[model samples]
Target: MDARPSAWIIAAVVTFYMSAALVMVFVNKAVLNSTPDLPLLFLFIQLIIAVVLLHAGALLTPKIEVPPLDLHTAKKLTPVVLINIVGLVFNMLCLRDVEASFFQIARGLVLPLTISASSIATRSRPSISVSFAATIVTIGFFVGVAPEHTLPTASVPSGLSLFYGFLSSLFIAIHAVLIKSSLPFCSNSTIQLAYWTNAGSAFFLVPFILITGEPGNLLALVSDPKWHMSTLFWGSLITGVFGFLLCVAGLLSIKVTSPITHMFSSAMRSVIQTLLGVCIFHDVLTTNRLISLATILGGTMYYTWLKSNQPPAQSQRPQADQEALDNGDREPKVGWQAPDLDEGLNGKN
Candidate 1:
C-alpha cells in the first residue's frame, strides 16, 4: 500500500477534520450547558462510543487492520490514555464555565505549549519565526480572554474558568508531545494508536466516573421523564456521533499531513467556532476579543507560511545496521525509528 497520500486526499481529510471538529465543539458546549454537572460522564460516554465505532470499522473493513493489544503496548500507551482523559476532562470543564468564543482563545495556548514540550522532550528547537509566532499567539490569547479588558457591559470568564482552560491547554500540550514520543511502539499507525488509546481511556475513565459520583447523576438524569426530550439528551447523542467522526477525521488529517497542518486547521476551526458562537449563542464579542482573535489567526497563518517555505530537515540518525557498522554500538532489534518532530502531533504518524 502507498503510505503517502495525494494532495487531494490531504485536502479532503483536512476539510473533514476541521468541519467535524468545529461541529463537535458546538455540540459539546450545548450538551455541557444542558447538563452542567456531568462533564466527565459525558466524556466517558463519548469515549465508549468512539471505541465501539473504531472496533466496528476495523471489523467491517478488512483493509483497516487493528493491531492486537498486548501487555507491552498497553504499558506504553497507559500514560497517553491517562493524559488524554485529563485533557478531555479539563476541556469539558472549560466549556461548561466559559463561553464558546472564549473557549478557542483558551485553546490557542496549545500551540506554544506543544512547541515548548517538544523542545524539552526531543531537544529540538523551532525556527526563530516559529518562536516569534508562538509569542504573538500567546499575547493574543491573553488579550482575548483577560477579564479586565472586557467592556463593563460584557460578561467575562471567571478566574476559575480561565484556570480550567489553561489546564486544559497544558494537559493537551503534554499529551501531544507524549503521544509523539510513543508512536514508534504503535507501528507509526495513527488509526491504530487512536483506537487503542481511546479504548484504554474508556477503561480508565470507568473508575474515574464512579469515583467522581457521576454514575448517580447519570442515573438521575436518565430516570427523569422531562430529560428525555430535552436538548441534553439530543445534544449528547449528536456529540457522541460527532465525537467519533472527529477522531477519525483527525487521525486521517494527521496521517496525510503534518501536525503543523493539523494545528493550522485547528486554528481555522477556532475561527469558525468563534463566529458561530457569536451568532448562535450571542456571545459577547468585545473589540479586544476580536483583535486578539485576529492576532492569533494571523500568527498561525504566518507560522504555517514560514514552515512551508523552509526545507525539510535531514534525518540525524542512520539505519540501525549502518549505525552499528559505523560506531560498533549494538542496539536493540526494535524496528522502530523516532518520527520527525515536525511531522505529526500526538502520535499521528
Candidate 2:
C-alpha cells in the first residue's frame, strides 16, 4: 500500500483548485452573464482534457493490470444508469439556477444526499438517532439566516434549482453505488468516467444547444480581453482534465471512510470554490447563504461521523480500506486507454 501522493494526484488537485479560482474571477468581471455560452465550452472542453490527462498518466505504468469492475451484474448496474441521467440534469440546473459561488456552496448538498442514498441502499438504515442528528445539523445550518433569501439575479431558482440539485445529489449517491457495484472495473488504474458522462450529457444537451441557439457569443468572449481569457483557458485546461479526476480519486481512495466522510472530504472543492468566489468575484456570503452552507455541512458531518463508527460494508469497497474486495472483474490487461469505468460509477468514474 503506497501511502505517498502520486505525481498525477498532485497534478489533479492543483488543476481543480486553480480552475475554481479563475472561474470566480471571470464571474466577478461580469464576463459570465446569464447563460454564458462559454460555460458549455468549458464543460465539453474540460471533459476532453481530463480524459487526455488520464491517458497520459496511465502511460507511466503501462505494465500494470487494469482492474475493470464486474459490470456483468446488470441488476446492480441498471438502476444506477437510470439515476445518473438525473445527476446530469441536477448539475445543469445548479449551473443554470444557483450559479457562481452559490452553486459552489449549495452543491454541497450532494454530501448529505449521497449519504442518505447510501444509508437507504445498504442494510443498515440511518437510525432514528442518526436521523435526528442529521436534522439538527440541517437546522443549525439555516438558524443563522434570515427569512428573506436573496436569489441569484441571472438564474432565478424557481425553487427548481433546489429540486434539481437534490435530485442530482440522489443520483450522485447512486453513482457511488455504481462505483461500488462496478468496483472491479476501475481498480488499479487512474480511471475517469466524466468524459464519457459528458459525452452522454452532450447527447442530451446538444439538441437544447441547437434549439435555444446556445452557441452564444463564445467567440466574442474569447477575442475580448476583458473576459480574463488567460484565466479561463488555464482553468478549463486544468480543471476539466485534472481537478475533477483527482477529486474522484480522493473519493475512491477513501471509500470505506463512510459516505458522509467521502462527501465531506470532497466538499473541500466547494469550500475552495466559495472562498475563490468571494476573493475573485466579490460574491457575497449572505446570512441566508451562510446558514445554508452551515446546514449542509452539519448534515454532512452528522452522517460521516455516524457512519464511520459502524462496520463498513464489504461489497465493492476500495482497495485502500485494506479489506480484500475483488475489483478484478476482468482478466488483467495492460494498456493506456482504460476500459470505460465511468459508465456506471455514476458518471463520476
Clash counts for all predictions: 0, 11
lDDT of 2 by residue, 184-280 (tens): 3333232434333333444454565556554656666666667767665665665554434443443344333334334444453455555565676
Model 1 lDDT, full chain set: 0.65
The lowest-lDDT stretch of 10 consecutive residues in candidate 1 is 340-349
TM-scores vs. true structure, each candidate: 0.83, 0.61
Error of 2 at 229 (Å): 5.1
Error of 1 at 296 (Å): 1.8
